[model samples]
Target: MRYVREFKGFAGIRLESDDIGTADDPSIILLHGFGQTRKIWEDVAVGLEQAGRHVINVDLRGHGGSDWPSDARYDFDAYVEDLRAVLGQMRTRPVVVAAMHSGWIATAALAEDAATLASGLILVDPQSESGAQSVRACAEELSASVGQGLAKPDYDERLLDIFDVDGSGARLLDSAPHINIPVLVVRGALGSGHRAENSTGYADAFPNAEAINVDGGGLLVNAERTEAFNGLLIDFLERKQPRFIPEYRSGSDARTLRDAMGCFATGITIITAHDADGKPIGLTANSFTSVSLDPPLLLVCIANNAGSAETLRSAQSFAVNVLQIGQQPVSNLFAGKGEDRFAGTRWEVGEYGAPILPSSLGIFECTRNALHEAGDHFLLVGKVEKASFEPRRDPLLYFRGKYRRLHFT
Candidate 1:
């Protein structure tokens, strides 16, 4: 059975998505390219559902039934944040399947938190980080191809704004290495956006990734070669192990389990709140994810040993500032023991009375709603009161015991 659903995206924009197949089945999330809506994945979703897989097709912000913000922010980070919000609401971590520009969004989102967000990744004819000129040329070509009748009424001309934005290039080169999950890169033989060299580079970057070219297929390989694409997808799914799940058994080595959990890549964040004395307190945390949309809730986990844990737990409000690629030092400073973290860091009090770090990829000013003790950490749930972001910066990442930056192809 198939059903339509709507979810709140970053900044409270409503996103239209379709859910197909049995709820208990393995899930595959499909993302369409620029200027396209979820409709593009209809055929592919049907095929996957027939194979006993649950398929979800989503219309990115400013397309289809989704709301287009007045800010006209159609940059890469906006798309990535939108996907992150959608994934947060899913009952199961899905295998993300993306096309062209959407592939970059998938890569960024997976890079942020692959363990909780996605099981596997499939990138089809994804745009290469070939530079601004190449992106503009591709966008122009796509705009022309859409013509007039083919375009959706809700399609904003600003959807092509990504071409002019800096840092719009795919960060797969840097992010792939951190993504320990299986990845499949599919390119059409004559695809304009994907070049053989770029595909090779992607495969080379990922420790567990492969590239495939579909014969006689063009940009929309899944549509042009539906049967072939479906066959390949099914084959890849069969070969990949089921999604990784943390197994805690009696007598399991705690250190060994911690090492295993580190395999999941995550983006860095500096969670800040004011203490009872009105002193600002902040600490670096990667255990953060959106929890609900009805009330706009998100949660971050703070270890019991963290110096700021008590402050955050008791504060009426806090902010989660997602670190940018240039904020490694800031992450380190907050992560370290005894030094004035905010003394040298550039920051200002947000409207919600939480410290807002400058140049962060995104910021969530939230009101602390609930706190629960889980193991040795405290789960602080917050109802987001304000949200903002920087469109031109890539996220700082942590994976496998090291800091990493996005490598634009």
Candidate 2:
């Protein structure tokens, strides 16, 4: 739930992301029910991502940030069209997931693009016509629990809010046949008696689908029973995968060394200084190591091809600013090739003519003690002219090649 989140979408139609973790394996796309915003699935998405499945929370048209139809009638086809446009904007073509009312609609559209749209599909708790009586019963049972606290609505209100339709029976019957994929129809265990029956009817309608029951769930199963639902969805998506996009970096030329470094965890440091003529020179480096604690000797390596390498190599002194785990933008700027790399960066001069980045986990103002040639890089050793360190913040890491934070806390 505390996952780092962001809002991104068109026409102010907000899309939310809570990266529980990276998606090295399975990716997921989550769709919310009608009248509900994308926030409904935020908790679930974070849980799935933390479990290693890439999860995205989708906002339906006229619901979240998606543009609303000037016309009052918000139907299934309009919802599907919104997804088509949204998918086109996604960084990755995600596995579509529809909860309850959205389940049937998303399934149909995805099946149409089945070949290239997704690596898998996760059909969350959805209602079906064949199971209307059961769902009705389940609805009634749930009505008993929060009847005093919440303003319980009638069947018509429930149907209209969830399916964007006034009627429930005909709607359920028509929607069931639309879902023909290997669906997982999840039902809340604490739901009305009719819900269980409707879920069974739904399972019977879809030949490739299975029915899973999550205890203490209700109409808003994805939100109320988020943990259970997320677990089931992640498990299902991971069970099988299609190599729609075999590589994370599409072409060989676009593959970054950082993607490969994600395998080996390493520490972070920023090396800065002045060249022979006294102009400022610097770059962020994660390949920093302590040579000797006795004399407090340290070393930072710079790649020969790096833009600041020449200036740093010829300098008489340089400062080592060991960064904390969360300084992503700072690392990006220093590692990037741009004229205004330090435009927004906060830094100050050390005793040695070198720039010392603010709030670094540790700062070592040093004079060039030694330089050793490493393959394609130079290891520059520095004798501590001045030193400083902080305890609370953890050291940053550069593994396999991307900047990663220590997640122990």
Candidate 3:
């Protein structure tokens, strides 16, 4: 099912949207390029809906059924603000799918608060960081290709004003590091205006991002190769595993179940404690999650055969250090069998007598609360005694058998 709705956008402009699929499904917000409307996403939205996703195709201000403000305040900031307003209205955080000029707006928005606003990002044929001259040339070409009957008479002219203004492209470059969400950059193999350098640049800026080119596709890659685009989009979503769906069943293969569980991304942590001999012992683990808040409880599973298993089992207290993006080497160090893991690692003794890694994204000092036998692993539950985190640091992530960094939305 699909329906049209209006949203209050930036500067009092009314943005129109086509809402599709069931409200209970995972949400995906699609933004079209300049001089285009929400209708451009019709085919893509249909495919997404079929895959059990709720899709919202939005028309930016000054285009399609959206209000064309007489004030003529169409700039990069204005576009970003409009998108922010639309996201604010969604019931859940959505995976933003943006193309060309709209991709610029999405980048700026994600740079501001990626952790809170978006779950993932898909940028198609994003606009290049070319100067005003290139933009003006592109505007002229677009105006000629799209006749008066196709777009608003003033769209091209107003769009030129936006491109001519300096700083939007620079801001995008500066804000790239702040985007801490998974991102996919898709470009058309034979596209113009969407430069290869710019596409690769976006991927390089992000902590966790990958780039791909669609064969025989141009600027409108989604429309040109609908099937390929849909497949790519769906695969990325499944790997991200934004919303957990229970699929437990009896008699499932152990390896298969483990593979399925890997779909759920988790932060890497090093569980540290002092053994009976007062030696600092630690092991890398991703099987750590909060269990309770009122009593501040958490748990980490350690393999019974692990070198530190006996130390952890006998320890009265421990610390879980959530690694940062810069700590991949540290995680590797602790995951290995031998070689002094803490020899060069900078750490300090916490109140609970556990070694707390320096510069970790988060540290949870805990008192050993309980231990339970589970298959080949022992579940060690802990009551958190103290917790601290670095707000500016991005977490080290693991998904689908690989280490991942947060890609700014």
The residue-level lDDT of candidate 2 at 104 comes to: 57
- Residue range 165-215, candidate 3, lDDT tens digits: 366678777777788899998876224433445556668877888887766
Residue 216, model 3: lDDT of: 55
Q: Which residue pairs clash in candidate 3? A: 179-408, 180-408, 181-407
For residues 1-409, write the lDDT of model 1, one tens digit per residue.
8889898888888988998999888898888777667776777788788666888898888877788778887777788888999999999888999887777778888885687788899888776666333434554555454322345344676766543345656465567677778899887622443344456565666668888877754454434566777778888986773433457676888876776777898999999988999888999999999999989999999999888877987899999999998899999999998899889888999999988886799999999899999989989999999999988888899876779777431
| Candidate 2 residue-wise lDDT at 192 | 32
Q: Rank the candidates by lDDT, best first.
A: 3, 1, 2
User: What is the alpha-carbon lDDT of model 1 when measured against the actual structure?
Assistant: 0.79
Error of 3 at 269 (Å): 56
Report the lDDT tens digits of candidate 2 across residue range 1-409: 2344444333334444444445454556777654455665666766675555666665555554544545433455555555655666656656777765566566656645553665455555565544433333434444554333335332233334433433544544454454444666676622332343535556766546666767663444434555656667767766555434324554464354444545567777778887677666778787778898767788987889988888878888899888887777778878777657556778888877788887888889998888999988999998888888999988777765556667521
Residue pairs with clashing backbones, model 1: 174-407
lDDT of 2: 0.62
Question: Which 10-residue window in model 3 sums to the lowest lDDT?
Answer: 189-198
TM-score per prediction, in order, is 0.54, 0.54, 0.55
Worst 10 residues of 2 by lDDT: 146-155
